[model samples]
Target chain A: MNLSRRDALAALAATGVVAGGSVALADDGTDGNVDPADGVPENVIGDDTVAILAAVGSVVYPDATTGIDPFVETYVSGRLSDDPDHRRGVVDAAAELDATARDWFDAPVTELDRSTCDRLLRELGVDAVDPDPEGSLSGRVRFYIVNELLYAFYSSPTGGRLVGIENPVGYPGGTESYRRASMGEETEHGRE
Target chain B: MAGSDRTPAPPADVCIVGAGPAGAIVAARLAEAGHDVVVLDAGPRYEPENRERQLDAHLRPGMEGPWGTGGERDAYTSSGERHYPLNAARVKGIGGSTLHWQAMVMRLHERDFEMDSRHGVGADWPVDYADLRPYYAAAERELGVAGADDNPFAPPREKPFPLPAFPPSHSDSIFAEACEALGLPTHSVPNARNSEPTDDASACVGYGTCKPVCPSGAKYTAERHVARAETAGARVVDRAPVQRLVHDETAVDAAVYATPDGEQHRQEARAVVLACGGVENVRLLLLSASDAYPDGLANSSGLVGRYFMDHCFAGVGGRIDRPTRQNHVGFNTTECHALYDGTDPLAGVKLEFLNYAGPSPAIDALHADEWGDDLLDSLRDSYGTHLAVGGLVEQFPDADNRITLDRSTTDDHGNPVPDVEWSVGPETRRAIERANEVQRAILEELDADIDWIVGPDETGPAYHHMGTTRMGTDPGSSVVAPDCRAHDLDNLWIAGSSVFPTGGGMNPTLTIAALSCRLADRLDRWL
Candidate 1:
């Protein structure tokens, strides 16, 4: 997690993916290169796992988040690249999800339509179960897949603004901004 | 005998143990006074550049490595009635706990000094508030305390604080309205954080991560004093934990400490000052047992590790309709000490209006059962609407609630670790319940939906360790005398909250600094 933006860029280059490289890798599933959205090297997590995670983010995230695919891909790659133990758990969960999708729809989760993917996740009991990394299959999926995507989205500056938390805990915008009573215009979207 | 093979270091005029606020101030003053001082600390000097990474560690789920304190070196045993998370709020680094402290630095009340005489419960401190008034002012200037003379309940001060007070947060303003309705007084809490730019550190930029890490240099850590001590020509030895005090019946000879190279060295000094905090102070004394004093050096009363005390925390939090702008400012700005000065037996409660309350939007969203728009809605409803009141209540010292050597378990150095057996009696429980009642009234005045409440049974320590090596006039019942010198040993002295006779309701760091200053002046005169 302490890996700087420059370090991340270097890591991406080391994995044969350069910054602003190409969308061809994302378009064609055959190539090992990931989508050059955030320049998070796909070598940490596989392209198929990234694709399924992106699809899952679409189902869980608000419909307004049209950029969820790139956002999730970038977030997951960054998240998985931090700790090896956590990466193994997340990777295993993604594989479990892909296997479940193939068993039900006779195809991978990324190939399924949006509505079918949503139904499939709910049917797998991810929506009903509590997120536990060491719990059942549904719990692991909810924890490593669903919860991970949600954490990535909400903790981001853009996603935090969607719910009126302009300056989240991790991001230090500045000092004097807290003197203001509210985020003002930004609070309107989250307000009832 | 441990470090007998190694050549003893050149003798210093004074040798201080622990580089915390207590030891730092003592060393700085002594070194500035042209005395040769050497300070031995158990931890490393953390770099300021790593604060961003420390903040990231705090932000991560489960808050791993926030203070970077753990593993074998920082190990201890807790056998309390209520399980004490010993490492929860401690930083063993060069600056000590001040590196991650919230920086609230209020003076102890006059009543806190005369607790036994007035309340007939805890023992009275040998030195009263009047004795420490000058030192209190000096400590405030030393730490750059920012405050307003608004608290009607506060003890009389000679002058205004060094810096102006930080403005009350938006949530504190909201809570102020409720407090006004309940006839409770509210005022800006005194903070060691800079309100404006000082010579040493910058003005607080409200990084909002004051507890685990302060990204900005505005917050005062004891590192400033340590730096000053070093600049004043005090030799500071970090990663050199003092193993034991080499002592005699009438006086102390030297301090034996262990270094990283797996070698022990004897640091000979004319005078020794133990400033290793409440728990370790006792542990070091007990570990220094010799043929001359089997009950521990300067512990003829057998009270070296007795009368351990800490402040118990109580809180009540609930959600309101609109945004309270929670966590906009990391530190609390408002507090009420009315209950602390009251005549009631359950009066030692100091209430704080927490600026940060409830969980972050990320946490709420992550834990939500709903995924899509419903999760977003839940986050909006729960994110910033939280308002909470926290209280710090005093725990009177009990002989049974003490720290002893856990010889059964060895530390990374293969030495016996400190075994903490802490427990709060009925008085503490009553005080916490009383605090919750006042907190509930303030929250209910705002028509908040009462959700969570931390009553007596659920309360935890504020980590203000006190009264282990208690200071009193009597040698029969106390370890140190009124001047913070050992009752048994002539040349040895104690610093920090470990010498406190009673644990007051306020934050102890300011008081700890004040006492350290007083001890320095005393030691200077003696030397």
Candidate 2:
């Protein structure tokens, strides 16, 4: 169940899909098919996977200002690369999602309409393909695809500001002034 | 002094290993008093700018390799029966482990010195709290401790803290209200951080990242003291790992160390101070085996690495009914000492209320299967509503729980790594249970919708290492004397929490600083 990145790529290769460069748009405005033999960067997702992630991200973090696709890609390329198990889970989940899309709509997941993609993802739920036996296949997909996107969004400077935190732990804003607002009055024993 | 062309160097008045809080204090005190002092550290001296860069790198995943060229930042190897994750908790740098410490400054209670006399458990400190009272005040002043003067649970102090206690956050207010309702004693825990700008450091604006690194120079670290010692004429050397003590039959003469480039250098000194933390101090002593004392230096009693102890810790957390902005304030501000008395079969316990933002690691397992809206809802409902209470329970020193040399594993320098063997005894287990019960009761009293309760089995590392080279009146039972001097070695002194006879239910940094000041005074009189 603990799939490596190599195993995930091999599985994709078995499907005859070529792993390619950065995601590109087709002339018709659909996801462009690229050669899987062309090497993808160390942490970057494949072109097809990137299109699938964008489709899934829009549905997951609908309110995100800059959209969740770019953030999800950056986080996956950087942080997710360090954990191979997690990366593998994400890759396998994306492949299964594409397979499910082809089965229902006879088109790739990224080619489907926004509402169709949302309904498809919601229905997939825990029924989605699980790559890791020790871990739930659906859970792994949720973590790598969904939870990671949420983590990147919430922990970001923009997202933190949305939550009223001027400076999150890692962001670069000066320290905050100590405020006593909303903290009840200090009593004689220093209890509020 | 030997008059040879190959002579390493003139002997220093005092040579201290490790530029930690204890060593920096000793070096500064001696150097300011016109004594030729030299301090050696195995890690690089990271300045403020460098610390910020390291902090940024540490926060960003896949960016942890930029601190140092080599892996000297985390050089130690922990093998054998380690119940807790020891290696990750400790850091090696110019400031030592204080670089990552939360800066909670609390003194060992008066009864901590007389554990045998009061509770018939553990050995009594040769020197009482009265003996260390002045030194404690001096340490607090030096560290710019901020605490309320009216904290009833604090040990009696002659002078008020340098600054008033920081204002409690909403989470602290909630905890305080709960403690008051439950009839538990609570107080604003003293912190080694600046509430206002000190003459040397900036004020703490509550950046809230005190653990891995402090962006602002608000937290008190030994690096500042090391810089002061350098200004006061102490020769500070970094990236120099002390190998062994070069000694004759009667007294120690010099210390041999290895540079980062694998070059060996010898430094002769009139007096030697081992301030390289609890585990390293014992390891260094054992490594410095001599013909006269084949076992180890200052280890004639065979108790050099015996009786190692760390505070037993347990954490309890649950969701509150109402949403809170708990993440807006400092991490550790409030504490409870209701169960600090030895009336219970278990020893005293200190509980701290932690303030942190979303995605608590405690409940990570629960979110593994969650996806989409379920995950989002879980995060929103649990993020700010999450409150945790941690207990630092007293641990009795056991000779079996010790640090020994692991010949199998070697560091980059080819030195045998330290193998720590430790397990909590029945008393610590009972204390942990009691501490968990106390935390649960507090949450229940506050009407918190309890989800899960965690005890010492799931508790993280405590990081308070003590009693590796304990001090006592008898040379047969202890490694150091009441004055922190090695029992067998005439001019060898040991500093830091290693010399503690017992670790009370509190942070040991303040006590370690106080003990270092006391040793400095004793050395001054003796010299």
lDDT of each residue in B1-527, candidate 2, tens digit only: 11112224478989899988999999888888888988887777676765544653544332353334335333455543555466655666688888878889888888899999988888899999899999999999878898887667777887889998876666777888888888887778799988789898888755556776776778888988888888888888887788888887668888898776658889888899999999889989998888898988889899988888888778787787665454554457778876786667457789888776345321231233444444445545455577778878888989988888888777777788787878777787788888888889888888887766657565544888899999999999999999999999889999999999999888999999999999999898777
- TM-scores of all models? 0.83, 0.77
Off by over 4 Å in 1: A1-60, A68-153, A174-180, A186-192, B1-9, B365-374
The CAPRI class of candidate 2 is incorrect
Error of 2 at B107 (Å): 0.9
Where does the lowest 10-residue lDDT sum fall in candidate 2 chain B?
B360-369
Worst 10 residues of 2 chain A by lDDT: A8-17
lDDT of 1 by residue, B416-477 (tens): 99888988799888888888888899989999988888988898889888999999999998
The local lDDT score (0 to 100) that residue B405 gets in candidate 1 is: 90
Q: Model 1 TM-score?
A: 0.83
Docking class of 1: acceptable
